[model samples]
Target: MRSEPTDAERALWKLLRAKRFSGYKFKRQVPIDRYIVDFICFNHRLIIEADGSQHAENAYDEARDSYLSQQNFRMLRFWNNDILTNTEGVSEAIWTALQDETSTPSPQPLSRKGRGALEGAHNG
Candidate 1:
């Protein structure tokens, strides 16, 4: 797969390689257990799979999805046509998924009085 990437894969790689997609590092053709994923971001626990016509309703892919879900890894699949024709849409979806995985709610701010009390405690 590394030596011969499909046109769609090659196109996506241009956007995803070298932490270019939202500063998240993505490895291509990564081995996970018994399967080799097309692209994976370990930091976000996300897998991006580029599927061709042959992958339609593939039973093996269903099993793969179930297994990855059990392991807390989210998978985003895109058809070769979508990747090639609507690259922006595919990239946007990937970015949204990445944000969903990594974003955390902001902490509540301390009031002025609370800050004073904490400062006094630390100074004393």
Candidate 2:
């Protein structure tokens, strides 16, 4: 997938790659559970998908997103056309989402120390 990215994917990759977007590292063609996502920021548990016309309101996409959501991963879908034509807007939207400043706060990572303390308290 890395070698043969769509025009839109290639364009977006430029912005997402090398931790250029707010210093968050994004991996391409990452396998999360059973699904392969276009771009994923592991630290944020965010998945970015670039889809073509066929994917508009696609049932498969919906199901896939549902599954990802259940697994505590946030999904963002963009039309291929939008990525190609409105690269800046797409990048800005992604940046905003990453910042967790949107209406819905993005998932924040749980610290291991906190998790362990909570677990110990519950067990006690």
- Candidate whose TM-score is highest: 1
Candidate 2 on 15-110: residue-level lDDT in tens? 899989878999999887778899989887778877666664466766777777767777666666667777776776677567762233232322
User: Which lDDT tens digits does candidate 1 get at residues 6-124?
Assistant: 99899888989998987899999998998889999998888887767566556777777777766777777776666777777777778777888753322122222322112211100
Q: Ten residues in a row with the worst lDDT in model 1?
A: 115-124
- What are the candidates' C-alpha RMSDs? 16.5, 13.0
Off by over 4 Å in 2: 1-3, 101-124
How well does each candidate superpose onto the true structure, as a TM-score? 0.79, 0.77
Q: How many residue pairs clash in each candidate?
A: 0, 0
Query: Residue 4 deviation, candidate 2, in Å?
Result: 1.8
Q: Could you tell me how far off, in angstroms, the CA of residue 90 lies in candidate 2 after the best superposition?
A: 0.6
Worst 10 residues of 2 by lDDT: 115-124
- Residue 14 lDDT, candidate 2, scale 0-100: 92
